[model samples]
Target: MRTDPTQPRLRPARRGRFAPSPTGDLHPGSLLAAFGSWLLARHDGAEWWVRVEDLDPPREQPGAIERQLRTLEAFGLVSDGPILRQSSRDTAYREALDRLLGSGAAFECWCSRSDLAATGGLHHACVSGPQAGRAPAVRLRIPCGESVAFDDAIQGRVAQDVGTEVGDVVLRRADGFWAYQLAVVVDDAAQAITDVVRGADLLDSTPRQILLQRALGLPTPSYAHLPLIVDAQGRKLSKSTDAVPIDDANPLPALRFAWRALGQDPAALESCTDLAGTLAAAREAFSPACIPSESVALHNTGVAIAS
Candidate 1:
């Protein structure tokens, strides 16, 4: 199960995906990521797919996934295949974990969150113990002193000391649900995802996922982390932060604004008569270099309050 760094298997290149958790309505931030990912796939002439990461039942809001899908359709962002729901892939994840366990690349740890919190989140508590089957979470046993590095399409040549920056991270949670790092890595490999475009909020977690990719013997996908939209106070806009969701009732204005937020100068509001035209103009003018690398606060004007 140990990922041979020198000989990591390179899968045949294919398309990309946008995997979003259905915890809330699609907000402006999420829309930015979706649009960016969609455009990237289109630019490469690759099939774009969508996956609903609904593994955490407690955090998933009822009906949120359907609402998000409708919103994406409203925004004119379509995917190629039937939407893949993570909840339906439990058997696949379980088999991957079993393989890792059998190969000794993964180990069961009974350490609770509280236990790890006390030791700064990276301390190994169960390196050696009786193979107890107490409701333990599975953790990828990271080899100490190994560095995981990847050349991010946007960030460029990023690296992290996996042993210290991220400890033996969890594959399965104490609640028996699979952790995002584990599921995302496995799914991306399984789906043959070539590129991953997401918001900058996940920039810090990229190195961890790279380590997981190394551990799981999977091919790593190219990544482009888009700039995050922040509030006036510099906080990332999220449901818990009370950030407003994208209004599907009138999406043109919001789409226009999102294009601007990503550093595109669209035609004036009066120029484009409809949403489709505005987005078409955007796709033609979309350039990754135009978007800012850092988070910025967008004024809630035409897009946020469009009738």
Candidate 2:
């Protein structure tokens, strides 16, 4: 007994996610990122999941997550699966840390602020100090002369040597919270993400992520880094930057703006009166390769920048 030879090979479903920190409301730049990710996933007939990156409690605003998700919904960017919150996934992260520690892929760093600045901060375990009763930060050991490279969807071929450019990166902070680099890598693997589409500002972090993936025996996904959205002064928009929140009362304007900013044609979408119809049209007409250029500035648009 054998399977039919003419049967097509079954491919696993592609998974893409939009993980935003709950530090602020949805700005135009973040909206653009979400829009691009949504279009790509929907166009591919893939799963689009949303993850709340609420790792740092101190930095998170009280109600920013709810506002952000509501804003995304008003723009017709609904997620496919139940939302995931990083704050609730501490057990998984701890297990991953234990595995890394057992495998010697991670080490406790005792480097002080002054030592890191003085020693170029590229090597791990360089300043092993008093570990009497303090919890030292955990750092990944980047092998020397290691080159991490990947072909990006938008930015073309990108490569970096983590050992040379960036030394051992912290996985856990002294404050006992998991570092973003470690948490993101672990969660991406756990979620079985197939592609990562996000702002180009995080392009530099890819190499480190790839390194972690390999070390942790996790799968590395394809990446697409969109151009950073800058303001009139060429400043990138973020919680720390000057970016206006998208008003939910009139979401059409901001939605159209984000669509155009992602390099999507707005000729027909502009006529749409409803958010769902607009998103449907954009998704049907989307082509990942057609998103021309990288950066978009919203200096005079009375909106935020593009990313």
Candidate 3:
């Protein structure tokens, strides 16, 4: 099967996702993430998927997942694929953990938070020996001087030495729950996600995910971390009481606000009156170059501070 040199190679279609935890309602900050991700996907003529990160049941609110999805729908940010819920994907995570453990890239960790407190909350070795009745957490064994580096589509070149800066990160908790680091890596690879566009708060976690992808022999997706939307006090919208939930009944204001927060010109959406029209205009006017690399603050009225 000889190939012709004149033919251009075909790149895999871009697949992007917006995975949200069901900890709370769809707030302005989250809307910014969803809108940014959806806009980028649409602008690239790619598929956009939604995933519910319902792994932490204790932290998740009842019916929050449904409400969040509904809000996205109301804002015309619909998923192109069937929704994926992390709660139903434990088997996949377990298999990924098993592979890492078998390859010696991961190990059973018996150290508690208190046990590693002296090491500034980083786990290098088990401080507390195995307890008789305690369950052990699983962690990746970050090799000495191991460094992960990648060119973020938006944030530019980013690098991190997991061994020094992060140390060993947990895969499965002692409480018998799968850690987010493992589940997210597995899910993204499973979904063949080519580009990850999310909030800048997750920028630091990108290297860890890339490390996991290497350990599992999976392809690392391109990353584009959008600036996070914080409250007036400079707290991330998710963690702040000032975070306002998007009112799906009247999506225009929030839609326009999110559009502006993405560094896109709000004038692109000013002519729109409905969700579909606003999204379409936004997609047409979206410029990856316009997106800010720094987090922006939002007032309770959905206004950007010097934005």
Candidate 4:
């Protein structure tokens, strides 16, 4: 199932997506990503989509998907198309993996964490031989000195040496789940997504994903990594105790906080009293240049509803 060399990758319509892993509830930090992505799509008159990254069943919480969708609905951030869940996308991932494997761009590695510990956890070449019952993790075979560079829409120019900085990346884990790097690339191309807007926390993972896109011959989407919302100690809100789920019972307060965090003027949403109006006004005022490159502190953002 190698990528047809005859068909060249073409840029599609502007499509952006907010992909959230259902490991926990949607906090303000998560809302910032959701809101920012939604606003960007609306501002560009593009299609916005929501995909649940539910590939890891063990880390996912029960009933989290339903709650996450409900929270998005409460905030008026509905997807332009039907929601896509990674759990149901196994066949597509397999096909993409097969293409990479057939092309010699990917390989099965028998290395475990301990096997690569001495080499700083980078799988240059598999050190451990295949075990009797253990399955080998599939990883993209990054050639020596291979590098990837892209101009981030918001973060500006970015570059990384794949072989040295990231080593070979896993496409399917030893635990029998499709890795995020592979699943995301496959899904984005399948959905014809042209733009990717998410938190800066994932900025490092971009190069790895871009490599996968090239390997699969899929069109790489424009990426904009938004600043992450951190806690008092400057920890990402999602990793801190302050990552409490924002109250959907009153969505405006949370929306205002996210809007302001995105560097949008509070005055833009100040006059709007409801979610619909606020979103409309915010969309008109949204500007990618206004987004700060620095991480935002949670406490620094005032959560009080605009009077």
TM-score against native, each model: 0.89, 0.93, 0.96, 0.94
Model 4: per-residue lDDT, tens digit, 210-281? 988988989889999999999899999999998889887889989999988998888888889888898888
Among all candidates shown, the one with the greatest TM-score: 3
- Candidate 4 segments exceeding 4 Å error: 1-12, 305-307
Better of 1 and 4 by TM-score: 4
Clashes of 4: 0
Task: Estimate every model's Cα lDDT from 0 to 1.
Answer: 0.79, 0.83, 0.88, 0.90
lDDT top scorer: 4
> On a 0 to 100 scale, what is the lDDT of residue 164 in model 1?
71
Off by over 4 Å in 2: 1-3, 239-241, 300-307
* Candidate 2's TM-score: 0.93
**For each candidate, how many residue pairs have backbone atoms clashing (under 3 Å)?**
0, 2, 0, 0
Estimate the overall C-alpha local distance difference test score of candidate 2: 0.83
Using lDDT as the measure, name the better of candidate 1 and candidate 2.
Answer: 2
Tens-place lDDT per residue, model 2, 114-165, is 7777667566456668577777888898876778889998999998988878
Residue 242, candidate 2: how far off, in angstroms?
Answer: 3.6
